[model samples]
Target: MKAVIELNEIKRDFLVGDEVVHALRGVSFTINEGEFVTIMGASGSGKSTLLNILGCLDTPSEGVYLLDGNPVKKMSNNERAVLRNRKIGFIFQNYNLLPKTTALENVELPLMYNPDVSASERKKRAMVALESVGLKDRMMHTSNQMSGGQMQRVAIARALVNDSAVILADEATGNLDSRTSYEILALLQDLHRKGRTIIFVTHNPDFYDYCDRNIILRDGKVVEDNRNKVIKDARETLKTLPEED
Candidate 1:
């Protein structure tokens, strides 16, 4: 498997007043292509900081981060923008869909950032992505016309339309009820099966099974990074995995 992302002793710090707050401290990890990874932690555990760094929305204070073999810290603003637009896809707890736009338009938004892509090419690919997420018929519907699950599916279509190798989702199911969350998890799992690198930040432990591995963080450090039965089949966690010892 190819290494899609590689981090080496990544560090991030910020100044608040006279004090310096360390968000990520010497963290290191790698995500290969097609891996489904779940990052879990409590509030202020530095998971968000890690996600931001991974998503290229923020840079690290120190150390190296390589995404798809390119050095993130060395990339120029335009290079970073291109890398984000073409290589990384992001989903958030909130759908982040444009309130007044139809699903097709929203999914087509990212294509605007690519100067090489024509509008018709964007529309065609956006429609294909929407259909992949089971929302092809709802492409013309505005955000207000969809349910939470549908909105998230639209978000997924937007993410996939770019053919992004890495899908960085932050608290993707935080707002949904149990059934909706399960549905979203299933969709994500299917995407993973189809060979997309899915990195999901989830607070709910129940959905761990949808991912192949869990990277647990606490107090801004990784406490665990291992494959577990809990994340093997979320439903099977209770039935087959050993009780927490």
Candidate 2:
């Protein structure tokens, strides 16, 4: 299997006033292509710091970070921006969709940055992405017209439209109800089964049983990183949940 992400002794430091705050210290790991991995930690454990680096939003102060074979630490801001756009699909806690924009238009936003994609091709790919998320019927609906789950699906569609190398989800289900969270997890599970490389950063313990592997962080360090021998099927778990009133 190809290594999609490789981090070696990664360290991130922040300056607040005259003090240096070490957010991540000597963190290292490798996430392979097609692997479904969950990164868990408490509020100050540096998972968010690590996510920012992995997404190319920030650079580490020390150590190496290889993303899909490209050295992220060596890239310029512009290069990193392009690399981020082309290689990583992000799903945030907030849906992050344009308020007045239709689902199809929102999904097409990423492709708009690419010179190679024509307007017609962008629409076509966005449609395919929405269809993959079971949102073809809601493609023309605006963000305000949809439920939380639907809006999240639209976000997922937008993430998928680029055929990105890594789907980096940050507390994706944090804002949803239990049933809705399970639905989203089921969708993520489906995506994983299809061989999509996913790196989910979350604190939800419920997520652990469903993922292929778990990586736990404590005090800016990786405390645990282990593959799951037995994984719970999200779809099956969803069936066991009580119906929402």
Candidate 3:
């Protein structure tokens, strides 16, 4: 498999009033295409710092980061923004859909930044994305009109709209109930089956069972990186879960 993301001795430092905080300390790893990798850590384990760097939202103070083989540190801010828009899809803990916008419009938001896509083309692509998430019937529903699970599905659709190289989910199931979380995981698992590269960051231990590999971090360094011998099916797990009243 091709390496979609590569981090070489990445270090990030922050100045907290006269004290220097080393958020990520000499971290290195390579995430290949079509792999579902979970990044697990406790609080202050440098997971967030690493997430920021991976998302292109922040640059490392001392290391090399390559996204789709493009050197992140060498890119200008605008270039980085463009790269982020084209290469990475972000799903947050809270579904970050616009409160007043329809699901279709929200899914189409990312495409608005790309000058090559016409309005008609944008709508077409957004519809296809929503359909892929099984939300075509709810395309016109606003965020307030939908349940949390539905909204998260819209968020997932928005992330998929760009056909991103990597889908970076940060505690994606944090806001959901067990059933809903399992539903989202099932959707993610389906995506992974179809060869999408995914990087999931979470503190929740339950997530490790679904991913191809788990990378554990502690005190700004990698503690473990291991592959799962057998990945669990989220859909099958759902069947075993007691039905919600």
The candidate scoring highest on lDDT is: 3
Candidate 3 lDDT (Cα, whole model)? 0.95
Q: In model 3, what are the clashing residue pairs, if there are any?
A: none
Query: lDDT per residue, candidate 1, 139-178, as tens digits?
Result: 9999999999999999999999999989998888888876
What are the Cα lDDT values of the candidates? 0.88, 0.94, 0.95
Reference-based TM-score, model 3: 0.99
Worst 10 residues of 3 by lDDT: 71-80
- Model 3 stretches with alpha carbons more than 4 Å out: none
What lDDT would candidate 2 get against the real structure? 0.94
> For each candidate, what TM-score against the reference?
0.93, 0.99, 0.99
Model 2, total clashes: 0
RMSD of 1: 4.5
lDDT of 1 at 79: 81
For model 2, how does the per-residue alpha-carbon lDDT over 133-219 read when each residue is reduced to its tens digit?
999799899999999999999999889999999999999999999899999999998998988999999999888989999999999
Model 1, position 184, has a per-residue lDDT of 81
Clashes of each: 2, 0, 0
